[model samples]
Target: MVAPMGYLPQLMYGALITLGVALSAVLFGAAFGLLGAMAKLSASRPLRAVAEAYTIVVRGTPDLIIILIVFFGGTIALTRLFGRTVEVSEFGAGVASLAFVFGAYATEIFRGAIRAVPVGQIEAARALSLPAPILFLRIVLPQAWRVALPAFGNQSIILLKQTSLISVVGLEELMRSASMAAGATREPFKWYLAAACLYLVMTGLSTILLRLAERRANLGYERR
Candidate 1:
């Protein structure tokens, strides 16, 4: 089958958009994840409850619904606050929606990692009179990262694939662009196969990076 001649450039553009959105979402999501984890472990009951509620609600809903609600609802809230009509860019909405979803799932990963840190270690830190900040920085966080890495990597991969859903909002992601190419060329199979190959490349590279991180993190640990 003759490949669609001009589809390559458009597919490349969509690939860049997908990567850009995922990268932004991951950075912001990490901040939300850390705070959510800290609140989950907080002494204040209200704070813990609020964090729990956030995770439960987000996880319970389908990702498509969450994206639509956050996108449309966010636009309405922003318009009311600013008292001016402003159009929300599809790219911006996609980033915020995906980031919110990613953060909710990351809360679980973070909370588990924090719990995995040995209680004895925290007790020893308290016995040594280490301040909260010092203890978290020097003792708790490093160990938590080691425990959290595998889950975090899985979440990262999920988020990357979730970028495809942004096409529903007409964000011109890889899938959307491929669809457009197929329509113009009247060759759906050719364009879709190209899109799949691009996705495979992105995911394969991510897997390699994750493996490297796992190796470095497990350094000096006793092999089972």
Candidate 2:
């Protein structure tokens, strides 16, 4: 009914790789999202248009398609740019693709979070003669983060699960490892079940950590 204990270590390693990919993707995505949010909120029409276009295109496309495009299209583009063949690693492609997708969604989340911060608070910060950087660092970002945490956490969990898609690109993540094991052992059900359980464990732990982070972020604030 259960997989052989011998295979557990390999699956665990694969899970670690999966987590690494998710974290890297999320970090890169968050950076992009921050920039996108700023652009969306800026007065510059061209910047706003570009950010809007990025979100619309990424959100409209399927994740699998995005992954394939980045893996194949990126290689082709790089080859053309360099006038030589270029090979893109599965890991890099996976991270970049997922980050691009994540950034699109995170852009809206951050934009909404930023907007949720009361205009009065910003006015008050300016009233205090605080510099722009200090005002954002000390006031705006803290509140925005508190507001964004739940949505961001949800996105991170989604990102974690999305790492499985990288298996299609031959990343040897948990799903890929399990599939290979299943093929060798001819135990599809057992290996797939193991992979599912590992994913559940990862997601479950992430939920707990996210809840803790949410609580920490909400410290000294009234909870509704």
Candidate 3:
């Protein structure tokens, strides 16, 4: 059975919020992931150590625990350090929490991609006396992005689904909105099914996009 007509607006609005949060997190996460990947591959020991530590801590913890720490513990930590009142929006906290988690996974994907780049190519660039930035920009990043696409796409889809965890912090995404509707209408089955279908729709679209990206990235590598 479908959700009541009255719940349509709420469900749509919640979906929009979910999309917004996922986008924000993914953007920041990509940036952080790139930086982390570079750091992990850097010659500097301290940089590598820091990058590894960050990945270890994030991957070692549960995502829901991270969200709670960011939403609740973050406030306490910030207030103490800043010596002033600090408040973060539930949406912002959700975005930040998910971004950090997403970034950790993305870092591994990017690092692997970077490693897959032929060392000889980098050596060739160095022999030609190309600046490091130029070598990376003109040669390294293109191939790395292609190599990373599948893993990045996977992370993106995971992050999108993970947005549901934000509801615990009281940001009214699809799950929270559906829960409220179910409570109000006393029809848990319908609203919950609606939420599940909405999530499946999002996942389906992401799957299609990822497949397209993979095909595009692998075009040059296809054998005749």
Candidate 4:
């Protein structure tokens, strides 16, 4: 049992919040990615261009810049729209920015995964006269899910670490909490070390879960 001291409890709470934010961002990002991937793969030229522009811009920019943009830009936009002062909270801004970045990468991941699906299967499905929706739900999505899992897991882990950046906006996630505690206690190394350990624990757990998921996703492949 660890000795109770110096805002460890608060830091733990903050870590939980960090996890929640990362997860929420990933969920939202996945939705954005699915649409973006569809647009990229679609026959429509304008949609493909729009999706191309989104990925290129987002991928080229730094995550920190994006965070700042979402944080300050959202507040400004909201205030202008409402004709009054509007403050965007750190949590909302952080999640939205992170989701935006994550979606850009995820769009590529999903697109690649979809492309990786065996073309022969799609031809067979068409030959069988399966509706496009049914074909995707029954066949394409499962293989894409498997192919995308490894990349998705890596992206999730990166997003988890990036949660620390939210500290700059004053969200009381682990990094911010540790910074405050370290300052108050004048023990920067100790508090920051604790924060690092907590992050490692979270990432380690995520890695393990991801491996398990990968194994499950590969079960059919193994059997064959």
Models 1 onward score TM values of 0.95, 0.95, 0.93, 0.95
For 10-47, candidate 3 gives per-residue lDDT tens digits of 98789889989998999999988999999999999999
Write candidate 2's Cα lDDT for 1-224 as tens digits.
Answer: 44566677878889999999999999999999989998999999999999999999999999999999999999999999999999899999999999999999999999999999999999999999999999988988999999999999999999999999999889989989898888777888998999999999999999999999998988998867
The lDDT for every candidate, in the order shown, is 0.90, 0.93, 0.91, 0.95
TM-score of 4: 0.95
Candidate 2 lowest-lDDT run of ten: 1-10
What digit string (tens of lDDT, one per residue) describes model 1 on residues 106-187?
Answer: 8889899999999999999999999999999999989999999998988998999999998888899898999999998888
- Model 3, poorest ten-residue lDDT window? 1-10
What C-alpha lDDT, on a 0 to 100 scale, does residue 124 get in candidate 1?
Answer: 99
Q: Which ten contiguous residues of candidate 4 have the minimum total lDDT? A: 1-10
Over 1-224, each residue of candidate 4 has an lDDT whose tens digit, in order, gives 33438488999999999999999999999989988998999999999999999999999999999999999999999999999999999999999999999999999999999999999999999999999999998999999999999999999999999999999999999999999888888889999999999999999999999999999999868654
Scored against the true structure, residue 66 in model 4 reaches a CA lDDT of 96
Q: Which stretches of candidate 1 lie over 4 Å from their true place?
A: 1-3
